[model samples]
Target: MPFVKTTWRNSISFKVLLAYVAGVGLSILLIALGAVALITSRSDILLTTDVAERTHELAGKLMFDVAGHPTGFDDSEGDRVWTFKSLGVEIGYRVLDSQANVVLASTDEAFWSPVAKSPPSDQGRFKFEREGMLMYAATAPVERDGTIWYLQFAVSERLMELLHQGFAWPFMGAGIVLFSLVLLFVFGACAYFTLGYALKPLREVSESAAAISPRSLHSRLDSKTVPSEVAPLVSSFNSALERLEQGYRVQQEFLATAAHELKTPLALIRAQIELMAPDKTRDSLLNDVEHMTRQVQQLLLLAETSEAHNYSFAAVNVGEVVQQAADYLQRMADAARVGIVLTGHTATQTPWQADRSALFTLLKNLLENAIQHAPEGTQVRVQCTADKLTVRDWGSGVEQAQLPHIFTRFWRGAHRRDHGAGLGLTICQEIARAHGWTLVAHRAEPGLAFCLSPPVTDSPSMNSSQESS
Candidate 1:
């Protein structure tokens, strides 16, 4: 089984998306802390205002003068003070004279101070633990007719506790979870969209670059729309393609020019051998010259067929093309004592879409190959359908190992008896591929079968059909 590879995990977009999500998580944490701080500040202000006001009111009722500091306040004001302690409101007060000595305190010593510690000298409200109980305490200066004294108040820490436990904890915990999810989702979507929008130009450049072949060497990737970070790479790749195109053009020109340059000398050689050919040596020399000439022509043809733009596609009559190839090679087949057989109705009825001359070249090469290898007195069968063409010959097929390289240029495989250039099947494959077809070679029990058709996953059956026939 082929491994299906996925690439998103390796992409920059995925990495950037993860980075955005991480930032969002951190932002939520900072926001949570800030919210708690703001709520704590507002809560403290409300507690302090109420505590200070009550302390001031209770101070006005008592004398600030040290000499007039009364410990026995048997009046309505004192009753109100006792009411708070009796009802367990946890509010306590201590009035101090000029020397910061406590002149009066609430009835319950345990509520104000269990230990004999001096009253808190600090002014602003604050929280502290006394005898394992949390308390909010504040001290403020009280004035009466130019005499200054200190009044300290303490309250139970329950209100602040209630604010945290009742609202802050539950709300913050839920808010963090919900806010994180929403932040990740929103930021994730935005990141993906940004990635797509940003990389679209690179995709266009890639697609255009993929289409650039030797035929399209003049084309260049457009760097204007690409991101600055990627533009240099694209420019370098385009420059590399320019150098490659120059080299490739030189190579192709060398093949064509060499093939053309050798033609006249080969022709003259063939003429000289033909003029003297009556003896066995002369005939053998003429045959060798002929074979060399064919190889030169095949080289020339390969140079032409290798370029995809050279093929002009049209609706070619498949049957007619096959008949023409068979007729053209009939003399050669007879010389080898091999018979040519054609099958299928589309041999006369046109149904295939292909390049006509290229198809003719393909069929000519295949038939010549089959004829050259076919055993004497045996038939080289040609089958045609609306969709495919098959050529099979009854001769010893190549080894299974050699079959795979049958179409490789100049690899003649195990066909040592052959004298022609190995470019016959190579040209056929180029033509077939240019027409979007597959030229597959299958080993027949007695010979080899070549199938020219569209690509298929199950090539074994389609490829070996001629052998079964």
Candidate 2:
């Protein structure tokens, strides 16, 4: 069974919208709870205040009645008790002497306590607990016959408790419902606006891309609808497409030129073979055929290098590549009478990640170019460093005026047109670009130096090797 790999997915707008919804919902819920609590607390306070006010008014009325009696109040008049019952509310009051004995009584026993303790303070409201009931009682002291008398009144607290519980659920439910509706509307509106604004640019990008094809490489995305945050990305994509189109055109031209060059040599070799004498000169014709074949192979390799996916890269030992290239070009170098010297070749190896074949071709081209241009007996020095390769030839250096055009395709230097085709330096530059490396040529004090350096890679421990040819 083959193992399947799963990619993690992420969406920025969805996450942001979800977070906003959650925050808004939580805030609404908290506000709803606070509103319900505040209203309920105010209702409770009003209920309590009403009850207190009514009790105080009733006490005042009773005091007025007692004071207005013609005989004034006497113990023998049989203490009067007044009880008022209305709207399921019962209030009771009694008068007592300083001995703490009840002088009057109320028939509403549920609202009055016979054994209720005296108030702690004089002339103020007091609360007392008795018989599993809570009582809000007020005591007023009156002077009669030079003696202090106490008047007390009480109303049961059960009524207030019932009132609070009665109104609680309805108000809480209404608050919750109202807040839920508000939040629902808010979230829906937010989602709509956010989705529309965020997806607008993406939709435009899709439309533009859909209308584009290989033939319409010049078409570009509309910048007006694109958000500022995404504009740079769109512009960069367009630029990259432009570069790809230009590369394609260059590649087409290269193929046409390569085909023409290769066809000429093949035709020449074939003609030479066909005209060979029947017996003796066959070997000489064969040599010419081999030479033509080598040239064709070289041209084919150059063509392949122009392809986008031609090379597979690996860590190559630069020293090994330079040694091989030098060995292959030894005879040509000897014929030119230009001595090749390899220096700074160390046992310590520097390995660079590159296409092995491409690197070999690049080194060979540089070496051959130097040999062809250098004066006789002048040594061409190849030097290697940890990250760079340098090839120097002690010969007639490149003219300053022609240096800029040396790497252009088919560009022949001022004094070296007959030596070979001028595609060597151009091919070397292409290889360097494909590998993300840098190649530079400069005139040294006595000759020319071609330097190549490997690009930096993410892995620090993976050292790069350099070779000069």
Candidate 3:
């Protein structure tokens, strides 16, 4: 699996959650500003309420007659209404009877007979002239028996400033801060669970996409389980897989046909040369033809091994395969005056999941190559363990730089013998890859060693440790 890097800025869920948070913050700021504006716009009403409350307290202190006229002070004159002045600001008030005649005035400023109006039921403010300055005033009705009296109070700019500084701004600021904190908590919690649920389909789609490879071309994305927004993309990818599978099949068929066409003619040419008299020129031509035939055969095997779908996986006995390869290559070993030695358990000892014919071919090629390079009297050692097969030749090992190129198609090292086309290791590598195995070369003291083993990357503990890290 390949690693994919994701940051908050690049993630869709993170960006959406960020947008959510931004919208919430904007709304709170707007509401706070609107609250400030509302208080500013309706300052008159707040002022009126403050004045009316104080007047009521003052009204309770005075004794009134049945006609709504103040008779005398209910309390001592030391606590009179005139002494109750606003902080840093002076305010004035007038007590009027039903006939609009002033019973008392805080200051004798422009004493005039204004229009007779009834006191309002709801709290409100009104404007009137006090000498030349503009004053905000409110009228509240005072009831004595059945008669009504009006208490009107006036306010100054200084009083409004005092209200803002004393209580209004502080209370509103605290309220907005508290509200914002609560909204942040709720929104954070909701975003976590909601985004997790919403993006689950996308995560599933990612896992399904990861499962796709050349071997699983027949499989398709489960578009029905994905989000509607991503369904089209998954469908398109499945369609691309279909096209790739067809193209691959066509290429494989062509290779097969070409190998078949070349093989028959080579066989006929070899038979014709065999019928001719034996000579040096004839022997050289035959050798060249034999090499060409071997290359063609290797090419076919390479094509088949490269195709993932061609191999049938089963419980292949590792020991049996190794012995069979050694036995089949015995004649070649004898011809080269080299011995084949195998040291492992019985045939049915180990069962590995692999393609039987392909495994046999891999072992045969390794053994044959080792025998070819092996010293005349030395032994080609074959070792089979629980999970691996090691083939070593006691010949001059390849140079360090040449090790990496051993499995390359048609690449031959300096120590590699014969005029053979070099597709054996490449085929073995392809077979190992198809079966999820690892084929590696190592220096075996006096010679070279080729190891075929199962891949160790799929362990659950290793996966967990990797993820944790």
Candidate 4:
């Protein structure tokens, strides 16, 4: 589950989808706010229209009577105000003189206090809240008997609020919910199709890249179909592969040519040294020539094994190969006064995919390295199972810190030997790598063991059998 979450977190398509949804959701929220503002403004406009029309009607009715009286008004002539009050509209009204005195008023004194102190010249509409009710008021001037009188009509907003809330709240809430759900669905569908369509070319590029390997470095990416944003990276990768292929070819050629050129003279020198008298100096010279010759031979073998094309992979028996290598190295083991023992083979031959010549060279180097490191009268054991071979020497094992550097070319330990230039184990590791095997070194009970085995991908069944055995 943690791995799944990690993959989801790193997914570009998921991130893109989330970003797209957030952007659209923010836009929808802004639009919904604007819509709410519009609805509220429209409700206020409706309330104001009702107040204005009522103010105009009241002014027409009261203009003549108020002009004649210009004093405290009686209830008999207040026809519209009385009718509106009877109908429970909660409207209020008043008339004022030029000095802002209340000449007439509704029975509800609190309703008219919002506009009672104003002048006749202030003949316009206004709005305010009074006692928790939104009120809209309008004033009109009536010139009668040479006195300016202001007639005002104001109404509570309870009816408007009821009408607005009756429909608006449900509509806005459902609209927001429905819009969000629809937007999420639509955006998710569109993003899936869009990303899939857009990344199709990238998928093609990936598949083509996966087909390329170290053996096929000449293959190039087809940039024509790839997105322009990614073309340069693919081009750079191809250029790097080209450089690596050229460098590797040049190195292999140099090593092979140099080894061949030095072989003839080194052979002649060894022959001449053999014909000389058996003196200490002569023996030393012969040993040096033999070491030089061994180095040249290892160099040529390293070059040959380094090339991927040189491998001829087939199923080879591990037991048979170990016995052959042991037999060939027996004389050297005897000279070193080190006993060579081969054991740990199954009755049924275990077949593993390998190149015959490279496998032999790998075993030869390991056996020789063990023999060289083994103390006199100590035994070097060669053990073979289904897919593995190990060479363990009963000598002083390498220190734990220096074990990692054992396969490096020309690397020697502190307790050094006089013979090798340290290419033997390097060559062995190179061959194992070229054949896609693992060569691991671990400390044994009293010495060190170098184990060569095929990779799990190549020999799963054989490795299982070996482990069980």
Candidate 1 local lDDT, 378-447, one digit each (tens): 9999998766788999888898988878899997745534687999999998887666577899988989
Q: Which residues of candidate 1, in runs, are more than 4 Å off?
A: 1-9, 17-122, 125-134, 137-155, 200-219, 345-350, 455-469
Collision count of model 4: 0
Top candidate by TM-score? 1
TM-score of each: 0.71, 0.45, 0.70, 0.68
Q: Tens digit of lDDT per residue, candidate 3, span 1-469? A: 5536688799998888888889889989898888788666756666666666766766566567766567644556565554434321356666777776678766554532232354343324566554454456666677787777667666665655667757877898898988898888887778878889988987887887786666567778788977788889989998998999889778878877788789999999999999999999899999999999999998898888877767767666788888888889899999889998888736337577778899899999888889878889999998888767789999988888888888999986566557778899898888877777789998887889998887566411112221221
Candidate 1 deviation (Cα RMSD):
9.2
Consecutive 10-residue window with the lowest summed lDDT within model 2: 460-469
lDDT of 3 at 204: 80
lDDT of candidate 4 over 1-469, digit per residue (tens): 0111347767778899889888888988897787777666766676687678878777766634533754433347545445555744467677777787777776456566555465657658788777777788788777787877888777777755655567766687788888888888987898889988887887777777776655466778888887799999989988987998888789889999999899999999989989999999899999999889988988888788777778777767777788889899999988889898988754428677677887888898888888888889999998887767789998788988888899999886554345687888888988776666789998896888998877776562233322221
Error of 2 at 326 (Å): 0.5
Quality of model 3 by C-alpha lDDT:
0.75
Model 2: residues with Cα > 4 Å off, grouped in runs: 1-261, 264-299, 456-469
> Clashing residue pairs in candidate 3, if any?
none
Quote model 2's TM-score. 0.45
Please report how far candidate 1 places residue 54 from its true position, in Å: 15
Clashing residue pairs in candidate 4 are none
Note the clash tally of each candidate: 1, 1, 0, 0
